[model samples]
Target chain A: MSHEIPIDDGYLDMDLLRFTTAGSVDDGKSTLIGRLLYDSKNTFEDQIEAVEATSKKRGDEHVNLALLTDGLRAEREQGITIDVAYRYFATPKRKFIIADTPGHIQYTRNMVTGASTANLAIILIDARTGVIEQTCRHAFIADLLRIRHVIVAVNKMDLVEHSEERFNEIVAQFKEFASRLNNIVDMTPIPISALHGDNVVDKSTNMDWYEGPTLLYHLENVYIGSDQNHVDARFPVQWVIRPHSDEHHDFRGYAGRVAGGVFKPGDDVIVQPSGFTTKIKAIEGFKGQESEAFAPLSCTITLEDEIDISRGDMISKPNNPPKKDQLIEAMICWFSEDSQLSPRSKYILRHTTNEVKAVVQEVRYKVNINTLHKIEDDKTFTLNEIGRVSIRTSAPLLFDSYRRNRTTGSFVLIDAQTNETVAAGMIV
Target chain B: MEEERHSYQVNHLAQLESEAIFILRETAAQFERPALLFSGGKDSIVMAHLARKAFHPAKLPFPLLHVDTGHNFPETMEYRDRYVAELKADLKVGLVQDSIDQGRVQEEKGPLASRNALQTVTLLDSIEEHQYDACLGGGRRDEEKARAKERFFSHRDDFGQWDPKKQRPELWNIFNGRKHHGENFRVFPLSNWTEMDVWQYIKAEEIPLPNLYFSHDREIVHRNGAMLATSDVVVPQPGEKVETRTVRFRTIGDMTCTGAVDSDASDLDSIIQEVATARQTERGTRSDDKRSETAMEDRKKEGYF
Candidate 1:
């Protein structure tokens, strides 16, 4: 299915990317967004006027860039961002979605929510202030969320006159600390002055001693093709679209976004759990049939010969079928306000498009993020804690390791009572 | 706007679009009765575009609801009619004049009177009359600070009140549309998009919009530092002078409420260029938002979209 094919629809030619930003209140996450919007010229006249009005109303000397993204009224009143304000800004290089997450400790759930779908996690650090505990906490969450790419932005370089010595010190310290992270890899460091527009879009001659892709350059050129799972073919059914409209009543195509791998119209595929084999029939989508389909593209597929496939059934090539098992081991970020991981606690686990009842079978060792070590004695996982655990589901889930494919490996724990999603887990 | 998609992990605009489409489908799948709020503005137009794409090759299952303040630019209504007819979607209009006639709401009696705020009452009455379970709106969080705290699936009580603290926690892609009798949900698919994104998307998609969005020669007068077009609703006073100038509206609402800005950006590219260097916020022209710091929040609490 993964073949070079020529087709038209030039605009949809773009691939999508989601990223999260984690930084302390002082690190200027909001300011960075404002700078990006302001420099990239994404902010509208009305919004800029509102920010200026609010800035004057608050009696601020300079235009408060942070005020631009701090959306909550209480947040603006308090002069701090409290919730995750997902911001979308596109450039010619790529369309970027910035999940501006809170750096405050109490808003850990918001951070986790932002981190869950991000392929890259940008950790902002105030250059004047070197590596701090807050930075460690954010980096830990990025790793825990399995974000393959990490950009450590040493912001506010203008404050220190773009000091190479200070930048090197922080970079060295960060690199050493990140190497200790068991889950983290692909660490990239860039010195930036978000306030002064240094290394954000244009390279700074002031930092000639440093040699690396500028912040914008890296964001524009980073290899994110491998971010998706193309090896493990897993499909979770969202909903079956029959249309049933005049033209096509016999269209019994299973519709869902491909969670991993590639599929074609005539490939040998296997339906999981049923142990059924069938030839591919048609790889259909909103734009109609195509020669190939890949991960994250929502489309419909009709099997060559009718087979038993329902909402939870996984689809993959015969050779690369994901392991189907009732017992699954995973690392999790607990996000509940009222619930904690306990033995025999039953919850609805929504993996991909499949929802099944899973119970906490055993309390696994909790890792100390600060020290990057496993705390075997501390076995209980509480809210906002990252830990290794095992779950036994009533039905088997076909999945790939989260490291291999985020969509296939990830699942959400929802409270059966309020129907509130409590935690996000990634299969280890 | 960024043309390249793979540079980042997810296309922000596409992610936002997909999320919007997902919400639209969920609205269609979950509610037996729903309506799309159409103000003929870019945001609402953007929502309509997404809705059309959500279930392409099929007509929009829901009707377009526009709360008329009885003080609207003639061009907006004309454009609204054309767009709906083109897409084959039903268009529903709730007139504030009827609400005033029925005494459901009393019009403000003063020089600076505006139906902008009063449209909420007629809107609520229409929703109740129609029993619409869900109302798809084009409100963006970046439009205002109060809106920033709003969830994509904002819940409203029977009386149409929005409580900041009472809002349900939005997690991942899961949106709770549950409500009791007389209660309805206001869906904002464009909540994450900024005004810039809307313009950029509109340009990229080549979506048709009202001529009011583009600059044209119009006679207008300055009042309270705002450029007000000389419509039937807006009359020039003894102190104010009306003059013809090239102006366009960034946001279109009640004629008494919407304000125009001086510009010559009649084409898509020029409009984007003007938006890129704009100095004032979009809502700066609307007198409604100036009522108070929490005006939008309070209005929203009252079931105002």
Candidate 2:
């Protein structure tokens, strides 16, 4: 019965970030995540007495903290934030996970499904409407989802009074429209006030002439550790344990999750579209072996020479491999609200733990996302559209280049007759 | 930004236990009647300890289901029968008093009566009596506000409901779990966990739980500001009084609307220091999410987990 408990293990040195915000219900982005979870105490007291009794039964004169991350019931009777919600918060250094997408111009496939596993991207911008067009379509969907750390924020800044010349004219008009976002890699900007809690989670005593670092200290100091791809190894095989047991008879192993570089225990690897190689033999880890395993560690390995890997195989690193393809080209994002993208259509694409049977074959242009241009005459694609297509598949995929590996460069499509998930590719 | 960029990172509870062991090995390589919904709670005993590290030496390729709500807490039925007989795994219960003596549900009647929404008709009648195309749950999109619009692969139809405006858009850790023809799929590999990352991953996986989550004395009954626990399915009205007190629960659901609190903070590092200074919300002492404000989005659009 050890009672002293001040609780240390300091959350085992806390590390996890995952960002993605976007804007539109008046760009406060749910009042900057309800002022960073109510000034970082992580909002409670019966969720602020049920958002102050639904902001005093909607007569509302304050206390709206975007009615605390809005949620369902037709988005709290339509105040907005229609889908991607995922909030969570933490502070003694880190643990965030926001995702909160949705910024109207028809949700753009919920901001490309909350910028696919974001390693940062906040966006917001409303400091008295400076970088509009929904802030260049939220920095072009955080640069078409390669999202390597963004932020921009600039929110209300107490309705532009704590100015700093309108926060350096909306951070030089959002770095001249996010300098045509070539896969971001750190943008930053700040100046907050999600309803007078300026510089979010403490710092702006009315902007002491704006000295920076506060949207929770640039989201608890963002480096996003080279946003993953420790250097090409991969992994894909999702499951194949085979215990056909008698206490320990021929165990087999493979399992998955590493999805990119650094894999060890003998390491020669290769397996992909059945290229074969082998070596690893013992990385294991559910509380055992593991001499190494990387990118996103969920171990198991064990090989040494029995190849024939399964669940859409792809163990990698033979000579930095990955890119087997079968006529691809990507950059998609449609997300079907009752379907449209034409050409040869087909679908069920999936990728990573692979799935195949894809068709499409051309439509290659769309972009316009708030003038990042290239509309090339509306190449018919519907629901939240963002184009460049060219598909083909029915086999060979194991890839990379969502700017080099966001888990073997992403893929989604599905809808081979309404199995839904419609579109969100990337690879190009 | 340099402790050499926190040296190849990984911590947040080992990247949420390697993204819940990669969505439980992508629900054991995408369903064929998948199950794991179990509720011996601490998020399904840390989702059956990450489904025993997601299929370790095999054996759990499915069954743990539970749905029982026959008002639990006999120390969660002896820790769900000694942890499903120490993970030789495969349990399956489903009762809710056999969906209320087979009328398929109808019991809630009075002084806060609650079969907690009759365990969603015995969990959609045990996923259509096991036609179960994937279930998995320990749902944690930081516990409700309609589970922060959950979706680690959540889709459900052929009647097990949940449509939070037609979900299906989860990208990247790519999870489509395609379905139709008596469809299903709940999945939530602890959808990005956070009840302080499941009490710091059950205090870094020492994971044992059920002594009704520490601090105990019992009796209880303060109501509406919460504390309730006077179980025998919580009967204590007419100007309530039953004291005893030290109390403890903070979410295990259904000993009549689960709500316990007073605490001495027994172990698991003083219950993660009383859940990091608890300010009410582990479902704010959930009396089934205190009835409404879209009560957990109308019990997740009628397919309540």
- lDDT by residue (tens digit), candidate 2, B133-159: 888888888887888888888888888
lDDT of 1 by residue, B1-305 (tens): 22123232344445556567666766776577999999888888888988876665456878999998878788888888888888888888999999999998889886568887788899899898889988999988767767867788888888878877555555445555656678888888887777766876776667888999888998998877788988777888888877999999989888877788988898987877776567777788887887776788778777788
Candidate 2 chain A: 10-residue stretch with minimal lDDT: A1-10
Residue B17 of model 2, lDDT score: 78
- lDDT of candidate 2 over A132-237, digit per residue (tens): 7867887888788888778888887787677788889779978987787788877878888788787787887878887768878888887778778777778888
Q: Score the docking of each candidate (DockQ).
A: 0.26, 0.26
State which docking tier applies to candidate 1. Answer: acceptable
RMSD of each: 4.6, 22.4
